[model samples]
Target: MGFATKKSKRWELQQLTWTFISIVMFVPLPVHIFPFVMLTQAKKGKIRSWYIAGIAFLLLELGLFASFVYFFGTISQAMLLTLTGSVTSYIIGNGLLLNRAKPYLQRLELAEIRPLAWIPTASSRNKIQQLPQAALDTPQLFIERLIHWRKEIDNRAIHQNIDKIIHLFQLLEQNDKMEAEKFLVRHATVVNVLMKYDEIENSRLYNSVTAESKKKLEDVIAKAAIAIEQEVTNQFKSGILDVSAETDVYIQSLKNRNLLNE
Candidate 1:
């Protein structure tokens, strides 16, 4: 019953499910369930779902070809049948799946999980160049980055702080876009700290020094969250926007952190 244990079990179950699908796809002319299963997985934001789908499709085709050859007792006849079936299935199945998964695929492209420390400078340069300049300074980009980072980081406190920060930015985007941009500009160090923290976390060299650096980074992110909450409250008090009920939760959190006077 720990959260991590539950997450691990869930992930294992998913892998097992995929494995079962692959086995089923290997059966001769198996039911076309893999494509539907693939679309479901892709919609859930699983990055490698397409890869699994492609491999399973190939297995399915191979099984069909083998079975056809065995039944017909002729390579030429089997080739013809296999070719027609596979090409037709590929065209129809993938067309529908791709159409349905387009939005999820685009979102995944925006926040592609990257190993900051492991990527070579030359390789990363191309990736950096591909991003829009406006996106670099946007709260949405940072939120996506933090979401991906949460998947890699194991600390629950860091996860909670990240969630809070994400919520604050979302509220700012909805209530006041100008204020959200100003907050990002004012707290530019938040971006730098996050980049440095990611580098250290992915370095895979856990030592006392790295541990201390991580602790400091966690504190920085927590403080940054507090600052963001304060900015939202300031916006509310200045008549820029009415204070929503959710803002009350943020104010309570800040007070719990002892950053706001009771």
Candidate 2:
């Protein structure tokens, strides 16, 4: 378990390092984005069906009903033809863009963004073989892969490693706690103490927090293994602190297990 923790921390540091590098090189995007995600719906485009429909009706009416209006002397026919032309053009453009062109353009955009290439080409698209071994072997990459595995374990309906142990401690949702312990060894006490949100008042650690003077310290542990204390606290204040609880557990558990004697 101590070995696991060391490996995970090493992996985390490598990831943060790479992320900082990528930001220095690549176009900027927020490291965290859930709050801004909801803002996506707020943006409205300039184009609308009413405009297209109006164009189509004008063109078609001039060709079709204009002649009829001239012969029959009924402006009503011209008006009907104009409306039809506008609607038909709008429907055609909207259908093509929404159903066919939109998806194709998106696929092209994704392919263009593939590693080591700014202008996407066929060879660059979805090419995993080009990645360097060092990039794959980096601690950050390893930790991300570990997280993926942790999720897979969760999906299998069993509790194993730090994830399940934390789940058992949370006591917030319906889950087979005993069943999880059947598959994995849960030895991380830090996680257990952190998850005791209800029992926070009873814990000495909870009472010791200086910044949180008024509210009972909400005992918590994030499973994402985030290292930066300030960043984690900011996320907590904003109400969406996604982090790794097991990172702390991994270290403390290692010390307890005598993996780090000093």
Candidate 3:
């Protein structure tokens, strides 16, 4: 089977396991077991797991309601408890747990670098061409691609510098400076250099010429990483100055209005 098919099957199996556990454990005592299961699944960083847990909870609740109505001939109190539990679980799971888990999940996804599937004889040109244009355009996608490239290179120094560059890009994106024209140009330039390095390192003919080109590209990559770091530092410094100026203006206004002591 293909990679996507394998991945889908794996997810299905996981969901099935969750469904079984949730129903088996929760059908008897939902109040005690449901929240625990939800919390556990939520921490796994899979939103689908949450949905599976919820559906199982509903099935359990339906079963309980039926049992109550059949035995006691009244579901008024049982229904009330069921409604309260469902609402509480929804609020706590969806509003609180999922919200808290999303950022952590996103970071994990961003940090994961998947390997490329290609023959060893594939040309560097073909390898570079395989990279999607969309990946290079978006900051998050570009960072992921950079991580994959970093893994391909065996140099420790290059790895450290690339890690710094990736961190800086993330910082800039958090500060909303990723789309600035200068930064965009710099990002594109760094990607180009890395692509060239990937090409040189993976070339079939590794003579002195390729070796020299590889060394030059490594130096260029190191320099580009440093430049990106410096750019991020300057951007942060500018933000600090802007915040300080605003704070000073606010303080002055407050003093003029006697809202604060001079």
Candidate 4:
């Protein structure tokens, strides 16, 4: 969705990219930037209307192309066209970058949902909400529903990839130590690991995946939630996913599967 090639040092590809960025910045893209940023704001999250943004951006690009062809009909008008091109590039760039930050914001929101102890309950006291009846009816189906929640916080335009990946552990920590330690012992093996009892304040996952951004993000988070850094951050917990809270979700998920009561 993005490219950051260096400015031209005589190469045609670089030159072409530079020229394109210029033309695209000229008008519609720039004019759209303000509205686009405003549209991204949410009372609880960053914007997530990426499909709509993509469609609108496509139309804007088409209009710009058609206009360029029509108004710059004469080859001699190249200079004036270049000026217009620059403006177009600026607006488009702004819109796209703002859009990209939405996912990061979502990740931050997810990050905020830590142990109740870490979060002050003095304001809006959140509760140990019960499983929604809908989720209570089908465990497997809802278990995999991780993407939309990710999008709500991480919808590309919000947070950095590092922070997003860090979320897996935060969820893991809450799952194992804070809420689900017992359930995990019954339903899973990882929860019985000795490191599940500590109360870590900050989160720190492996940051070694420097080869590719996407690969790095997935690999680090997907790796087992065990490490000296994670151990320290978790307040030296003894295990992975706690069996108690794990059991609650497991049972609920099973109830969701028609196995037990909600």
Q: Which candidate is the best by lDDT?
A: 1
For candidate 4, write residues 13-91 as lDDT tens digits: 3323423443444454323342333233222232245435544655565665666666665655664765566466556
In angstroms, how far off is 30's CA in candidate 2? 38
Candidate 2 wrongly placed segments (more than 4 Å): 1-74, 111-262
Model 2 quality (TM-score): 0.18
lDDT value for candidate 2? 0.33
Among all windows of 10 consecutive residues in model 2, the one with the lowest summed lDDT is 37-46
Off by over 4 Å in 3: 1-129, 132-135, 177-182, 204-206
Candidate scoring better on lDDT of 2 and 3: 3
- What C-alpha lDDT do the candidate models reach, one value each? 0.59, 0.33, 0.57, 0.36
lDDT of 3 by residue, 76-112 (tens): 7766765566555544443433343323233234434
Model 4, C-alpha of 40: deviation from truth (Å): 17
- Number of clashing pairs per prediction, in order: 0, 16, 0, 65
Q: Which runs in model 1 stand beyond 4 Å of their true positions? A: 1-31, 35-77, 80-135, 202-212, 239-262
Tens digit of per-residue lDDT, candidate 1, span 8-95: 4454444346435533453334445555555454445444545466466666756766666666755686668776786666565555
Q: What's the TM-score of every candidate structure?
A: 0.51, 0.18, 0.50, 0.25
Report the error of model 1 at residue 40, Å. 6.1
Q: Which consecutive 10 residues in model 4 have the weakest lDDT in total?
A: 192-201
Error of 1 at 20 (Å): 5.5
Model 2: per-residue Cα lDDT over 92-194, one tens digit each: 4334333322222323222232212222222232232222222232222222223333332222222233344333322211233343232122222322322
Task: Indicate the residue-level lDDT of 103 in model 1.
Answer: 33
